[model samples]
Target: MSDDLTTLHDDGVLEIPISLESAGNSLDGDSIRNGTDALHEVMRGHRKARAVLLVGKGKNFCAGGNVAHFGGADDRRQFLRGLAHDLNTFTDALYATQLPTAAAVSGWAAGAGMSLALHADFAVGEPGTRLRPAYPGIGLSPDGGMSWLLPRIVGLGRARTILMRDEVLNAQTALDLALLSELVDADQVYTRAREIAADLANGPTGAYAAIRRLLMTTYSNTLSEHVIAEADAIADLSITGEGVEGVNAFLAKRAPDFPSARN
Candidate 1:
């Protein structure tokens, strides 16, 4: 755990909770940079985690960007550049990670905060939680991969309606719109996400990574290119220790032990 308020707990499952002193519990420069760095450290490097469960502390999962720090100055530009670099690095690392990721939202997730939650493989929000896009309200556009991910999750028309209107979508509506995978009780947000992460961690790591890669590359790959990629992925997975264990475990009717291997 870091003194900045973000807590990382390991209890048979890895849990990363975002707690900040900014609006909507959103991450500011210090919070985002420090928390992202700390997560890489705790996970023992980028993409090393078997699974990740992202949660929020207190009431809101996140409210969005910290407007208090927004200003125009040389110092501000430098800060903004550094912040963008670090965040993009962290986000890219997370996206490239070999593990399954889940977001557990408790209350309000607006603006960039909602974008962060949407990045997860599975998004779980409480019934009373609110999901909104507040960028247009502030005369700004989307960031934090929101522009790319929003349209993919919800169609272009629906995404435009949400972002343009800056409307608040409740948990059930978000679920109906495919913004969330499940609607859970507020109290069970973290617990349920942890369980989901644990389930993924217990599965085949290499195969999971291949699946993630496939999904990520789908948008850019041509039909012929995708076929080649699929073949490459299958061939790559067949040689890993995980592939061997997967087959053995199935034949033996026993659980596989995917202990960490140091090269």
Candidate 2:
């Protein structure tokens, strides 16, 4: 992976840094491209990353898109279309990944940055961390699944209020609204996030993936259909090595050692 966008940690954590000190860590075209490419590489088995950690390099997490680029683009329409396309693709990949994901957020998470952080299964933020939709403020519509995710996360009315009013939510508010999984000290954000990711990585990956799939389709499925899906999922998983091991471990009164860990 390119150092500019991401770095793979030895503990199987893929770290994508959203901050660029020179540009105040704002999202840029290159960062979007590189970060997405890195995610694809990991998903395709080109790299070994059991979990992903989205973070910012400096004090601020991400300041959203580079507005300067928007003004400078000779073909503003084409530029914006391409940028949004790449960002949407990246966010899609993030949501589809089998690996559990986490984020260590600080300072500001605005626009696409907020979307990216929200995509993670678990996001840890400090007390000072702030989240904003930031689209209406700049006369733009939501992208990167913000429209879909926000409503699901905070309900339709609250999501509408947030987007329409450009409400900036602090870490506590975000946590209260279920946007953040945990709130920690500024210095402990990354450490706590990584610890959570590592714990997830060591657990039953297949089961985790199954749960993600089930939840992703929950709203779309009827209760009868959902129960059938759940039954099928459990039946399928029951025969897997991890599932067998887990069952056996339970019966034997011992800890389960998942097959993924052995590999």
Candidate 3:
């Protein structure tokens, strides 16, 4: 990996390797500014990336914010607040891309680390992987969208219990709760995530984006309102080259070659 640890593969998957054993990727500090910049490039459609793959390199996927830094700051309150703004900035850029995303989460995902993994549409982990809503343990509430994401993935009641109780969830439990989408062996986590992300990149990128939009907004819409949104999405999609190619491929009885229709 290079200084920024970001690479765009030939397959149209943007591979961002989180290294130094925990990405220590604070939403607050400068540690993740490079990633934020990369995501901004994607949002501008300059990267030509169809999907994103996040790989964790180390014994743990991420240990969250560097606790040492947390304590080192002289003005602790201002420092934390600044970090919050940075975290929000990074996450907002990632969300704006509307691309399919996956993560190779191989070991302990704690504190902001768990929140980061939750951003992925699919998180591939090992059987030994673990998740902990470690914010409270550090005398803080959740950041990095943890508060919003947990409830959506596991339900409000269950999410509440987990957060309030500061639970350390095992890999199997995390998978069962839909927190981790897939589980493989420890060594295969990154490979599996890349495979899945590449497959997504080759798919109908526009449709995947629409699905992400629908799912993210579903809770805010009632049945009647949601159906209208769904109709609008498909109607808009039908007029695109991707839609036409999909229909033609189906009629021709062959798999869709979406890349050929890429604009």
The candidate scoring highest on lDDT is 2
Please give the CA lDDT of all the candidate structures. Answer: 0.73, 0.84, 0.84
Model 1: which ten-residue window has the lowest total lDDT? Answer: 5-14
RMSD of each: 3.0, 1.8, 2.0
Candidate 3 residue lDDT tens string, 60-83: 777677778789999988988877
Candidate 2, overall lDDT?
A: 0.84
User: Clashes in each model (backbone N, CA, C under 3 Å)?
Assistant: 1, 1, 3
Model 3, which residues run further than 4 Å from truth? 1-3, 22-31
Q: How does each model score on TM-score?
A: 0.85, 0.93, 0.94
In model 1, which regions exceed 4 Å deviation? 1-14, 21-24, 42-48, 71-83, 259-263
lDDT of the structure predicted as candidate 3: 0.84
lDDT of 1 by residue, 1-263 (tens): 33544544443334555545435487555556665665566456632456767767668888876666666445876765665676676677566555677888888888777887887888888888898888888788777788888888888998888888888999889989888889878899877877887777666767877888898788899999999999998888766788777667779998876543211
- lDDT per residue, candidate 2, 60-106, as tens digits? 77888888888899999898898889888877777666778889888
TM-score of 1: 0.85
